[model samples]
Target: MPKPAIFWDPAGLELDSLGSNSYLRSTDGDTPYVSLSIRMLSVDTPETHYPGRSKPARSDEKLAELASWIQEGAAPIDDGLAAHLQPKLETGRAGTLHGEQGEAAHEHFERLVEEKLTKPSGRKRRVYLKSGNEPFDRYGRLLAYMAPNYTRAERDEMTPLESASFNLLMVASGWAASFIIFPSLPKHSDLCLFQEEGRKAVEDGLGAWSDPLTLTGYEFRMCVKLHTVTKELMQGKKLSKAERLRWIDRYCCDMSTRGVYSPQDYYRVPAYDRIFIWKKDVNEAVARLNLSPEV
Candidate 1:
């Protein structure tokens, strides 16, 4: 029997509409940059009130109810339920230490608290240095290895016609960025047609940003703007396939211009890095679905 089709959506991330957040607007003009926010949704939290019920139902039951509520558009969780569950969620068994590892973890936790307390009121503070020793590195490595493999599998799982259509979308998205960065490339003219095909794919996906005509216009201007900025870099007669790919990587991943400047003037902030990294992951996931083989 054929395996079930999988649909993926990255949770807890939101794409803010233009003008919703004042800080996200471009400094010189009204153009908007995407602002991503992460939200915590606790599954252990209950939603209803049933006075004197047997221990307020099991944890698994509450989780199931939460899923149902979300599917039904997330009805407001009452204070009574939140009050009962919050303590349970917060309370966890203390770690049993056998060696220096326990002491180190405790020390790190205390240092984090001290740093948080030292920050000035109304001022932005840095958190989580980019050192590879952080707790999340193991998970990151696993994901990095798995994603490309998953993409390859996903691609092979599709029918021949589906593979052709999906690959066309990937090429189109690539070309959209390409036209902006290196219009002098041999296949530059093909971008316009590829872009139209991309629009159709976006519409079919029913994505939040799916507006074919508007996206096409935006992409055209984006290509022109990118060309203007990187013209000098692309000066030598023609850029190779690898060089063009590098330019696309830089163009889509460039958050330098969107540097944070607020209560603190820190140019490179931890939050900025985290958000950008998460955005890159989501973008790659989208690309994998389009171009990689299924798992």
Candidate 2:
């Protein structure tokens, strides 16, 4: 499936002239007319396109087994995570649950954007965007954290957490998972806040967390990717060194270890310890973090 799209914008010359300062024309230097996608920073909502019949297909059944194995690998990070996913995996309904939660997250997210960006008079306001440490992701999408375009004085009225970026709010509200990656990890103060919010959300069983089977967006995508290879491995097929290395590069990163690992070793890294890094960004991530992958 194509990558999901959200928080994308196409800024016109008029808005740029009005000082929105979106500089949406980054992708089109000569024309100054095109828009680009924005991959919101530090949060990931559920997968919206995973097909589901609420009953396991042969493929779904296979994926379920593979997912369970991956969950076991992640058990060291948080035993509760694998425990939480167990019921749905056993019933072969993991994919269906993911799709359902994805829909719920989408609807809630839409309402949130409307509530945050609409003036009481019903006119819409532009969202506030702060670019990430890196300007763009490997997908060419701008990476940003968005919030209401409140003035500094207006924002001062609210507590910092209340005024926090929608990215953090999404995690606080439990509709999305905290997904901060290396180099984009915020300063200590803000990082503490995000962690607190995430802990609270999980404790409160809010949104998708209310459903024990819900997979974070990253986990959902990983299951989709690794299932096929996992199936081959299960059948006793051996990968050549190049293939093994390629799959490992594409497959493993752990949050707890803050290290990249081979798929066989990836499960040892623990859940929530996994971080997202695109293939092209691996070199940069390695350089920035001084990582040594488990080859």
Candidate 3:
């Protein structure tokens, strides 16, 4: 629990959201400075907007299929929460809001920020970026635990195991999923804190946790990738209902240890296990080709 050195540039970065987790940040708040897309680290919220206008992510039919799989698998949702989640689950099913709970998480975070801005006391704020062991993600976004206007000095009195991470706050508040990209980063405190918070949220049936589905960002990515890879193998052939599940079983077993990327790939979760939590949509897509369940 030794303190990692804080990475901070003296000049403030002007941070504004392009969407839920992505931000457009500049070196200076007023005068122009080098700007880049800052995606919050270790936090993945349900996306509320489309990727068409921003830095492009891999968006295609396969991704759409992945989204639908996540939602469809979460069917027969709680009646009390279904109303708010329907829009997020069904909106632009081809691209945005693919999860069962939809954009509720996105809206929740936005509303929280907006409320902070309109506070009558006019609280002063600063963005604190705590660089993790790995500073850049595959997408070229800086991987740092970001806190808007909160600082280390505020938490100096706390013990080594304590965390004041806004990123952790998101999970603690049930607004984001705990996305651990690098497990060996000596980030035990924050990692443990987020896991505890995430578990509690799930136990309380909050946000994405409400569906009783919990996955790291890397796990989610692997689920989508696994589906795409399986589809490619089938090459549009329709499989019988029984064959569909069997195919998934075979694919997962074969790819369990096969490296999806390279030596540094962080998706350690096996495909076979992820199948139970991540395969509904892919199953339906294959089922559609056959038309008849028995076929």
State which candidate has the highest lDDT. Answer: 2
Question: By TM-score, highest first, what's the ranking?
Answer: 2, 3, 1
- Highest TM-score: give the candidate number: 2
| Residue 12 error, candidate 3, Å | 24
Provide the TM-score for each candidate, comma-separated: 0.16, 0.68, 0.49
lDDT of 1 by residue, 88-133 (tens): 2222210111112223323443453344334345453332211111
Q: Can you give the lDDT of residue 87 in candidate 1?
A: 34
| Residue 56 C-alpha lDDT in model 1 | 21
- Expressed as tens digits, the lDDT of each residue in 182-274 for candidate 3 is 321226566556656766775786766665334333333443444544464447665554444342221111112222222112223321211
Give the count of colliding residue pairs in each prediction.
11, 5, 4
Q: What TM-score does prediction 1 earn? A: 0.16
Global lDDT of each candidate: 0.28, 0.66, 0.45
lDDT of 2 by residue, 1-295 (tens): 9787767777523322224334554445465644556788888987766534332233357556765775667212235434544555666767667777778888988898888888778988777888878877764677888888887887888898877788888888898888876566666676677777887888889888898766777666655555656566667778665543333343346544557864345445533344556566778877776677765
